[model samples]
Structures are given as C-alpha cells and as structure tokens.
Target: MTPLLEIALLNIRPGQTEEFEAAFAQAQPLISGMKGYVRHELRRCLEDDHRYALLVWWETLEDHTVGFRGSAQYQEWRALLHHFYDPFPTVEHFVGVLP
Candidate 1:
C-alpha cells in the first residue's frame, strides 16, 4: 500500500508564532514516538508568518487516524500546541499519484 500523507494547514494566533514553535518543538517527540510514524515536518509559510503547514508521512492511514490519535500521547500533543491556533487547522490525508 502507498504511504499516507497527512497535511495540516495551521494559522496561528497573532503574536504567538514563537511560542507556538516552541510548543511544537516539545510536542514533536510525542508523534514521532508513535507506532507506524514514518516522518514529519512543520514549515512556516513565507507569505504569512503566522501560517504553517505540517506534513507527516505514515505507513498507513490507521497509523495516524487510529494509532496516534487514539494514543494517550495525543492529549499531550494537543495540550502543547492546540491553543496557538486562531482558527483550527483543516487536516487532510493524501496519497502520492506520481513519482
């Protein structure tokens, strides 16, 4: 099966970018340590400093939707980073269609 890509478009609260980054730094290990996690990256938007994109590769859809989200660690992850959003991000999953 093809690997799943999870993408989250994040819009941070004004003046909270630095704090959000720091919180995310602390939260990163929580997801990285989960089952079936392949890799992930968090990137800041060039046009908008308060915007970010989080991309994560998982071995399968369940690896994220079930494995990570169902784990107790998810709560910690939420606590660390959830408050930074002005509006919550929209998360979606994708599959690669080409090389």
Candidate 2:
C-alpha cells in the first residue's frame, strides 16, 4: 500500500512564531516516536510568518488516526503545541495518485 501523507495548515497567533517553533521542536519527538511514523517536515509560509505547513508521512492512515492520535503521546503533542494557533488547524490525509 502507498504511504499516507498528513497535512496541516497551521496558523500561529501573531507574534508567537518563534515560541511556537520552539514548542513544536519539543513536540516533534512525540509524533516521530509513534509506531507508523515514516518522516515529517514543517515549513513556514514565505508571505505569512504566522502560517506554517506541516507534512507527515505514515505507513498507513490508521497509523496516524488510530495509532498516533489514540496514543497518550498525542495528548502531550496537543498540550505542547495546540495553544499556539489562533484557530485550530485542519488536518487531512492523502495518498499518491500517480508516479
């Protein structure tokens, strides 16, 4: 099966970019240590410093929805990073449709 890609469009509260990034760095290990984690990347938007795009690869959709989200680590992840957002981010999953 093709790997799954999880995407999140994160918009941090104004003036909190640096603090959010620091929190995210601390939260990274929580997600990366999960069972189906393959890899991930976080990028800041060029035009909007408060915005970010996060891409996380998993072995399967369940690996993220079930394995990761259902784990206690997720709580820690949330506590560490969730408050930085002005509004909650939306998360979606995708799979490769072509080579």
Candidate 3:
C-alpha cells in the first residue's frame, strides 16, 4: 500500500512557543515508535512564530488513525502537547500523486 502523509497545522497559544516546542520534543518519540511510522518533521512558520506544521509519514492510514491514536502513548502525547494550542489543529492525510 502507498504510504500516507499526515499534515497538521498548529496554532499555538500566544507566548507559548518555547514551552510548546519543548513539549513537542518530548512527545516526538511517542509517534516515532508507532507501528507504521515512516518518518516525520515539525516546522515553525517564519511569518507566524506561533504557527507550526507537522508532517508525518506512515505506512498506512490505520497505523496512525487506529494504531497510534488508539494507543496509550497517544494519551501521553496529547497531555504533553495539546494544551498549547489556541485553537485545535486540523489533521489531514495525503498520498503521493506525481512521484
């Protein structure tokens, strides 16, 4: 099956960028070790310091929506990182089209 790319646009609370990043650093390992995880990256928006983009590649969609989201580790991930967002982020999946 084709790998899936998960994208999330995060808008962090004002004055919370540093703390949010610190929390994300700690939470990264949780997603990385999941069953179908291929790779991932987190990027900060240059124009908006409080905005971030998270990209994660997975072997299959279920590996993330079911496997990871269903695991206890996700709870830990959420606890560590969720509070920093001003408005919750939207997560979407993509499949390679051209190459």
Candidate 4:
C-alpha cells in the first residue's frame, strides 16, 4: 500500500513562533516514537512567520488516525503544541497519485 501523508496547516498565536518551535522540539520525540511513523517535518511559512506546515508520513492511515491519535503520546503532543495555535489547524491525509 502507498504511504500516507498527513498535513497540518498551523497558524500560531502572534509573537509566539520561537516558543512554539521550542515546544515543538520537545514534542517531536513523542510523535516520532509512535508505531507506523515513517518521518515528519515542520516548516515555517515564508510570508507569514506565524504560519507553519506540519507534514508527517505514515505507513498507513490507521497508523496516524488510530495508532497515534489514540496513544498516550498524543496527549503529550497536544499539551506541548496545541496552545500555540490561534485557531486549530486542519489536518488531512493524502497518497501519491503519480511518481
């Protein structure tokens, strides 16, 4: 089966980019250690410093939706990172259609 890509568009609270990055550093290990996790990245938007994109690759959709979200680590992940958002991000999953 094709790998799943999870994307989250994050808009952090104004002036909290540095703190959020630091918190995310602490939170990274939580997601990285979960079952079915392949890899992930966090990128800041060029035009908007408060905006970010979080991309995570998993072996399967359930690996993220069920396995990770249901794990204890998710709670920690939320605690570390969730408050930074001005509004919660929208998360979506995708699969390669070509190449």
Per-residue alpha-carbon lDDT of candidate 2 for residues 13-87, written as tens digits (9 for 90 to 100): 999999999999999999999998999999999999999999999999999999998999999999999999879
The whole-model lDDT of each prediction reads 0.93, 0.94, 0.95, 0.94
- Residue 34 local lDDT, model 2: 93
What's the true lDDT of residue 31 in model 1?
Answer: 97
TM-score of candidate 4 to 2 decimals: 0.97
**Candidate 1 lDDT, 16-78, residue by residue in tens:** 999999999999999999998999999999999999999999998998998899989999999
Evaluate residue 95 in candidate 2 and report its C-alpha lDDT on the 0 to 100 scale. Answer: 90
Tens digits of per-residue lDDT, candidate 4, 57-99, equal 9999999999999999999999999999979999999999999
Ranking of models by lDDT: 3, 4, 2, 1
* lDDT leader: 3
Question: Which is better, 2 or 4, measured by TM-score?
Answer: 4
- Pairs clashing within candidate 4: none
Q: What residue runs in model 4 are displaced by over 4 Å at the alpha carbon?
A: none
- For model 4, the run of ten residues with the poorest summed lDDT: 1-10
Off by over 4 Å in 2: none
TM-score, one value per model: 0.96, 0.97, 0.97, 0.97
